[model samples]
Target: MSCTSSSMDIVPDDTFNDFAPLSKRRRVSDCSRSCEDSSCAPLKKFWFPDGDIVLEIQTRLLKVHRRRLQCSVIFSDMLHIPQPFETDQIDGCPSVALVGDALADWEVALAWIYHHDEFLNQVVTFDILSGALRISTKYEIPGLRRWAIEELSSRWPVDVVSMRLNALPHAAEAITLAQECNVPEILPAAFYALSVQKFHASADGGRSHLVLSPNDLRRLIAGREALQDALLRIAVDPLTEPGCANNAACAHCAPRRAEYWRARLAPDPKSPWSTWLVRELDWMLRDDAFAGTLCPACFHGHMSTIKWRLGRLRGAMPGFFLL
Candidate 1:
């Protein structure tokens, strides 16, 4: 029976050992048609003598309980399908080959199935969460996928307030991951973060154009230009507040704010991109000297106005990127 999560036909090969060095690992392609090939071996950790099924993944064979495999909806559905007249088997159990699935991801996802406590009690890295999400999504493991998405949502929030407080890591990868997993909620923040960090040459020194797909690159470019225009519009427009106690002071501050943004956004000869206005505004809010220039009432009022405008712009980020 076919039980692959991703696209591709399955081929099983010789011995599998998790502890083996990368250099010594073998591929199923390198083995002969017969199981008698010396290179093929069962993965010691996952191989169970009493297990009912042997999962062939590339060069490794993992014999696990059928019940545990059934936890995944896709696997469960596949298990119910009738077997062909001729079937592959390892030891005494039937073998199911999974093609085009990453062994590392399978390892992590399987760990979650067998050792749930380890993930529950520990802080999982981004790579681990990413792997789990991919595998669970591919395998239709709803519970595991939900847990991974929840963990990611905490880091990459959908709303403005939480987005401001958190710095999203792996911005480029996160964008692709969001699209792949159909997690549109995080796209705005992920795209915004990448735009702020400079897409051409990111803070990590990698070229974003090289990492992002053509469509994503186009969206990023368009969204970044929209952000620049939005910042200019906000800066040039009036910053009046009816509640301002000192209209005179507030009037002067408005021009100063516009000039501040203009100067901050001035094009640099060395770099074509400018800093994101949201980051600049965040810094301005914390600048005591800037705040000191206005009366307390005016300062708070103007700050509120700026925040409201930026918040609105931020909310439109998904559309800005055509997301």
Candidate 2:
């Protein structure tokens, strides 16, 4: 993620525990509430203390500048309504009751609107970025929406290995957020990362909310099986040939190198291929001592073949995740 001017710490994992289905939160009536109410008082302390608009999002209240809300077409239209009693009022300022979104998400969105330079400068985490994307899209904030999408797309990996390395920790949540926010660009890599981790229909152990959709789960399972088979076939191909050196180097080290490749590409099904294998192969290719184990002709031949095969595998990977 790129930072713009000011930044905040990404929300921690424990913080996400505060997020529950909207139905579970206490619903605040959209009727008028006195600003003197304890629940409504603290929300008045946001930037721009004298802003004309207050948004009661879930249990939290936010004071926002009317000019800032006008930057969004949706908000602009919403704020233009002249019917005063039709909306909630606090301290004589119009209060828009925004329901069905988490307080954390609203905070991020409002922060971007009021303190954009600072928000942009901070290093955003997956959770914060996804929240911004959701709110921006909902409010028709085109600029912020585009920034969120670009940040996500830039961080999303193009290959399975890179995806596994960078996205595996949060693959499930990322996939769900991408789908909800209409960000298809992150799906391929996110899905592939999930596939590599081995799709499990019951993986979330009945926590369906934390799992992918049934259709996506099926696609991941099929793609993973196909990729594993292709990788095994490429890795286990015969390395010895009639014209190759028949000396001790060929007889001993060649088999060991071939075995190494086999173990990496086709590990026990319980211990499937992972980023470690990719890193190991990369190191072997670069280390002079490892490369010296084989004769010059055989070494170059095997390296070239492996490189070509891996390239093809990577090229074909994206298609496997297509739904």
Candidate 3:
């Protein structure tokens, strides 16, 4: 039941249908069935006698008011349909079976719907946000879906600069979620975050949870190589440092600056070049001592060149991933 990507496997493509009809609904699997009588218990927190409709999930039922769900086009249409004679009833309320959904997803979605004010004010977890996103997309709830996407965007931004600033946890899971759901925009950022992480083989020789799908692995490798190439090109490019007004001092400092860059920017076995560009740039810019040996003109020029080239690379990251 852990929602973190590190503990989960890649979700299959056909795991959930976006708008499956109720007529084609499949019965809950026998393993998930609570008892021999095929009866389901009400979920403790969501059950309410005063609620108008009862929703039957795999092993539990949830009673919620019609008004709360009517905002969703799919839910509204489903609710208006006349119930058949065989339709189950819970405490005189018509019960509808929800197909192709996980109970956890519904729990998160329903909690948000019923207590949105409180939920919005509270610190949201990835589990709650991802669950809400999945359920809202299934039910065609635009408002909740938008809210979930916007919340996720803050952590995994579309642009490279913001994405570098906001590091996301469980990036592999986020990538899977993007592929499974319709959130393609966050894929580039998620993939970039995953690329720099070092995943080791499991002790038992089993597949690691951090392992990505074959296609994703290919894309990650290609994109990471592309980024590394871009960084290397920028690092080795000739510096256009026109001698400052004090030409002698500036000329003397130039060779030292080149040597410093060669030593500091050289590729390290432990650290990836793709991730080092920003970190090194920040280090040099933050502390004047790092760039103190160079003349002001040379220092500013080198920094500007690094920024410009990296910015261009960042812009092309999505294309590098074949996205």
Best by TM-score: 3
Report the C-alpha lDDT of model 1 over 1-323, residue by residue, as the tens digit: 23331212222223322111112122343222333442356778787778887666778878799899888876676566565434444565666556566677888888899899986777778788788998888777998999988877777778634555244457778788888887888788778877766445545214677668999989988988898877656546546434434333356566776565567655565663456566666666677776677767667765676566556666687898888
Candidate 3 regions with alpha-carbon error over 4 angstroms:
1-18, 21-38, 83-86, 164-166, 201-211, 234-251, 259-274, 279-293
Candidate 2 lDDT by residue in tens digits, 1-323: 11100111122233223221112222247544566672644464473567786666666667778888787766565445444244445655665555566778777887888788999999889878888988887766898899898777666665544543555556777778888888877777776666656334334322323477887767676777776666555465645333333322355557767776666555455643243334344555666666677777667766765565555556666677664
Candidates in order, TM-scores: namely 0.74, 0.72, 0.76
Kindly indicate the candidate among 2 and 3 with the higher lDDT: 3
Span of 10 residues, lowest total lDDT, candidate 3: 1-10
In order, the Cα lDDT scores of the candidates are: 0.66, 0.61, 0.64
How high a TM-score does candidate 1 get? 0.74
Better of 1 and 2 by TM-score: 1
